[model samples]
Target: MTHLTLSDYDISAERGFLCRYDAPDVELHGKMAAVRNVAMALPKTLVTGRLRDLMLRDLPNNVEADDIADLTDEQARMAMVHYSFLIQAYVWGEADAPALLPRALAVPMHALAERLGQQPLLPYSGYVLDNWGLFDADRPIDLDNIFMIQPFLGGQDEAWFVLVHVAIEARAGKVLAAIPTILNAIATGDTDTVRVELEGMATHWAAINALFDRMPERCDPHTYFTRVRPYIHGWKDNPALPGGLIYEGVEAFGGKPQAFRGQTGSQSSIVPTMDALMQVGHADDPLKAYLDQLHIYRPPGHRKFIDDVRTQSSLRHFVEGAGDRDLTLAYNAIIQAVADFRSRHLQYAASYIQKQGKTSAGNDPDVGTGGTPFMKYLKKHRDETKARLIDA
Candidate 1:
């Protein structure tokens, strides 16, 4: 019964699930400017105690949930981005992470995270979705025109890694736009319309995979494992922080440790959305459980979109029964695309994280940033998707 319109979920044909926020606006001035100033310099200030020093001196104080509640949606999102980056740097920037987050950082970050309905740390929405801007407003959000607005180390590798994800999110708009059309076409038994839309969806997916293929162009595997991967890790399931992280002054936490998943590509709603549309179900397993846990990490609207697509779509069932060669072929093409993307992602997981040597306690090479034995499940999901293809 849920409407499938993009705007209903704050999504769009131009940006897909990516946040519509652009950086460097007049709104980020005044009180919030201090947060951005500190975040912009986080990479350069990552000496043993330098980040902590900069944060205590430079970060604004007395930020409460009420203050976040007063701002417009854009300002709130910007605040989340700045505060999330600063919190991650404070926790992971040094050689050893501190068990306790100071009251100054903990209080504001907790309030912002509460207001945004996410955990009090970096999230995919803040990390990649909202953490980007255009080099030139007139150009598209392609790799050439886009750059990461916030980064842990601000290197070519880091920027390239994040920017590639952004580019894929932009390209996904077309595929998302086709969802309702395909579903409605299925309902009307309009096989031709369904076939055309499925073909288009598969084409857009190919472009997304092309973007994924460029991951190593600038983000070296070793650099990604050491520099880029370490800071984004959350405390849960991490051997380094067995007790999890403590937010010293976030009264809601009662001085106990908090555990949340790190920002990983799995949190992106694109694959989930596609899975929902195709009705590709994963057997309940550790990876499925981890993915279910990550559902809350996404923006609430995205969660709704995925759920609606799953419940409402009859594409797979229709294709299986249509007995139309072209329609079944179109549906099979999309299934194959999803399978291929997962396979490439599995390869990257092995090369980018699994094969790389361990450099820090927090970043376990065997575990994914989201805290799963990813290699085993990535293969499972890929095979499951491929098996869903309609048989001739």
Candidate 2:
């Protein structure tokens, strides 16, 4: 019944989204447009908190370009971690709940997914290739999270569907400025309307990335990030972790079996150290956190797929620097996982082909003579993906 907007959250003012863009002339205007559009969409009461006044409206029109750049990239990166889980939360959990995005959505991998998906997979974490496969499809449930549903009665469909929006939003902050527009269409569940937004998201990513790249990060990444090193791995310069966002408060949801298991214990961070053999690890790896993020991304198949991610993460980390013997063993184990999945699918598809065989109205047109439907799907998808997603 109600619409979704980002102003409902406390972190609205602190969000570092626009800073990542180098819009000297447009920076302040861009910031205002982003905030006002969302703020105006919701009741003024929602956006009028003290800091919101201070943070949203009071910042100087000539806000320092440098501070914007630095703060924004950090927050933009942080946005993905929170945004990823919010999708899942909106899809599966209570709509009127507190900021689950802040608490449950703090995993590094999801942030990394945002980073890669936004930045184009070059500096990407190794886990992405094995775990994620996204086609640019938007669902009727996009923005179905706590922030939106608290006022509406969005059950699973609404909650799970929000993830489609989160994935798009994290990388394209400008689109987030247009949340009301998107949700209005999503609420209608009109295929044509949803398609318009989805196409915009694809282009918004292109334009935003282009904006960020226009200004050379005057502050070097090495220098910029070094300031964060003391905070990131618990070195204790500021007595806080990244985002001052404490993560220990998160809990494991049993329904999503793999959710946070590998992430939970550097030891349990998936199938446990004994099972996964700790192939990959860091003091603050965010594997568990990522699961919390994934929790809302796919509510219907939440447990199985998250378990898949957890299993995938642990196995990936297990033999990073392993010896020849260990490498061979680990590689074989991965090979088996791939083979088993492929074999199962192959069998299922084969059966479908067999059914088609019995129903053939005409004579068998040479079983292996021409290409099969599966082959066409695989080949077409592969070529299209390469052409569209891969940069020359």
RMSD to truth, every model:
1.4, 24.3
For candidate 2, the TM-score is 0.24
Q: Write the per-residue lDDT of candidate 1 for residues 216-302, one digit (tens) a residue.
A: 899999999988998898888887777888897788899899888888999999999999999999999899999999999998899
* Worst-scoring 10-residue span by lDDT in model 2: 261-270
lDDT (C-alpha) at residue 283 in model 1: 98
Tell me, by lDDT, which candidate is best: 1
Off by over 4 Å in 1: none
- Indicate the residue-level lDDT of 52 in model 2: 27
